[model samples]
Target: MKQTIEQLADVELTENMLKIAKRELREDKCSREQSLEQMRNWVLKHEDLRNVRLDDQFLLRFLRCKKFSVPMAQQTLLKYLNVRRTFPHMSTQLDFLDQKLNDIISSGYIFASPNRDKHGRRVVVINAKGFNPKIYNSSDQARAHFLTYECLMEDQATQICGLVHVGDFSGVTTTHVTNWNPTEFARVFKWSEQSLPLRHKEIHLVNVPATLKWLIDFVKGRVSSKIRNRLTLYTQDKELAKHVDPACLPQELGGQMPLKAIVELWKAELLAKRETILNLDKIALLSDRGILRKSNYSSEKSSNGMNFVSQIESIEGSFRKLEFD
Candidate 1:
C-alpha cells in the first residue's frame, strides 16, 4: 500500500503520506467529516485560530505543504488567514463578475496551461503582451491574478503537483510603469511569499523588454530572497523554451493553442464558479468579522506575516520529523 519514491516525486497523494497526515494532522482517510471535527476542536483550544476557517480541504493543503507537521501547518494556516485580516482592502472583497476585472482575467494575460510538467505540476502562464495598462491599473490586475491563483488552489491535484509560472513580457513598456504602485506590488509579492500554501515549482519570466529592466530590478529587491532566486529571466523565447517545455506554453510562445481561445476558456470557467470564488473572501478576510479585534499577532506586529513563519520554524524541530523527508 505504500507508495514508491517515483510516486512521491510525481506529487501524487500517496497512501503513506495520507496515513502520516491522518496521524499527525488528524486528517481523515475516508471522509472530511473527521478531519473537520478535529480541526474545529483544535481551533477552539487556540484563540488565534478561532476566526480562521477550518475547512478540511483548505487545511489539508497546508498540511501537505508542511509535510503534515501539525504545528507548522497550523502556523502557516494562521498566517494565511492573517494576510486576509491584515490587508482587508485586497482580501475582503473580490468581484469576479465585474466586467473590467473579468476582461483582465479573460484576456489570456494569466491562465492555467492545458498541459502538465514531468512532475505533473500545472503550468500557469502570464502573457504581459496581453496587458493593457490603459484599461486596468496594477492593483486591479493583481486582484484578477489573485483570484486566478485562488481558483487553482481549489483543486487538490494542483496543490499536490504544485505550479510552474511563466510570465511573458514581450511587449510591456515603460508607460505601463507609470500606473504601477510599488507599495501595492510589494504587498502582493509579500502575501504570496508568506501566506499562500501552494508550492512554487518554478518561475520563468520570458521576453523581457529593456524598458522593464528597472521594473524587474525594483521587484527583485522588494521580494524575499527565496522568490528572487527562484525567478529566471529570459530575453528570448529560445532560452525560455530551453527551461519550460514549449508544448506546455501558449501559442504566442510556440505552444499548442492560441492565447485568445485560452483566455475565453478561462473566462467561461471563472464565470461558472463566480459565487464560490466570491465567498472565499468572506472566510479568508477578517473584515467580515464586523469588529476588527487584534489577532494574537496583528499585521502591525508581524509585517507580511513573516513572524508566523519564523515562529513555526523555531518549533518545527520539536515535532515528530515527517517520514517523507
Candidate 2:
C-alpha cells in the first residue's frame, strides 16, 4: 500500500505505508491491492477483530471476502492469489468458504486435505487433526459434561459432510474406539479420504441466520420422517423438560448427552448465575400440543382461536342453502 500494489512485494510496511495507500488514485495506474491495503488498514484501525490472530481461520475468512465485484480492488486480486497460494483447490470458489467450513465440521474426519507440502514448506499438508474423538462424543454424560459438541454414530453408512463446533477447548485432542472394527475404520477412513465438495450449494442469499436455516431446512427434509412421527418437531421433550440429559430422552434430542449428566450441568450453570428455569409439568399428564391455547379459544367454540388455520368446520350446524343448481 505504501508503494501501491506493485510496491507491496518489495517494500515492507513503514509508518508511511497507509499514507501512501490513502493518496488519491490515478487513472488506471493505481492497483486494487493498494485500495485493499487501505481497507485493511481502515479495518485494523476501526474493526473489533483488528487485534485478532491471523491463523488459518483468519486467513481463510479474509481471502474469501468481497463486498462488491466491480473495478476489482487489488485486495480482492491478492485474496484470489492467496487462495490459490494457500488452498489451490478452493481458489475458484473462494466466495463460498462458509460452505467449505460446514463440510469440515459435519464430517468426523477429512483426509489428505493439503496443509503442508513434502518439504514442509506449506505447498500442502494433510489435515486430519480434526478427527478428535472427544469432540464428537455420542454419550449424554460426555456431551453435557461440558455441553460441547455431541455426536452419535448409527449403523447406516451415510456420508456426513458439515461443520460441528465443539466450543472452545483448551485441552489436547484425543481418540477412542468402541465396538471397534478395523474394517469399519478402514471404511470410515476411505470416506474421509474422499475429495469433498463445498458443504452448501449456492443460491443468491443474504443474512447468515437465514442461510444457515436454509441448510437446516434442506437437511431436515431429507431426514427420515419415521424418526419424527410421534411428536411435534423441535419443541423440547417434556419428559425431560425438567432434565436436560440426552440419554434419558428419545434418540432424536441429542441422545448422546445422558439425562442425569445434562441436568446436573444445567443446574450448575443456572445456580452459578442464580437463575431458575420454571418446570411447567404436573404429576399425571404429559404435555399436550396446543393445550395451552385453551385460554385464548373462543367462548362458544366459534373457531376463533390462535390455531384457526388447523381447525375443521363443525358439521352440526351444516346448512345446504345450495348456491349450486
lDDT of each: 0.65, 0.25
The per-prediction tally of clashing pairs is 0, 22
- Which pairs clash (backbone N, Cα, C closer than 3 Å) in model 1? none
Worst 10 residues of 2 by lDDT: 150-159
Q: Every model's Cα RMSD, please?
A: 11.0, 23.8
Best by lDDT: 1
Q: Please give the distance, in angstroms, between residue 258's alpha carbon in candidate 1 and its true position after superposition.
A: 1.0
How do all models score by TM-score? 0.73, 0.20
Taking the tens digit of each residue's C-alpha lDDT, what string does model 2 give over 251-271? 223345433344344333333
**Relative to the unseen true structure, what is the C-alpha lDDT of residue 308 in candidate 1, on a scale of 0 to 100?**
43
In TM-score terms, candidate 2 sits at: 0.20
- Give candidate 1 regions above 4 Å deviation: 1-38, 46-53, 284-325
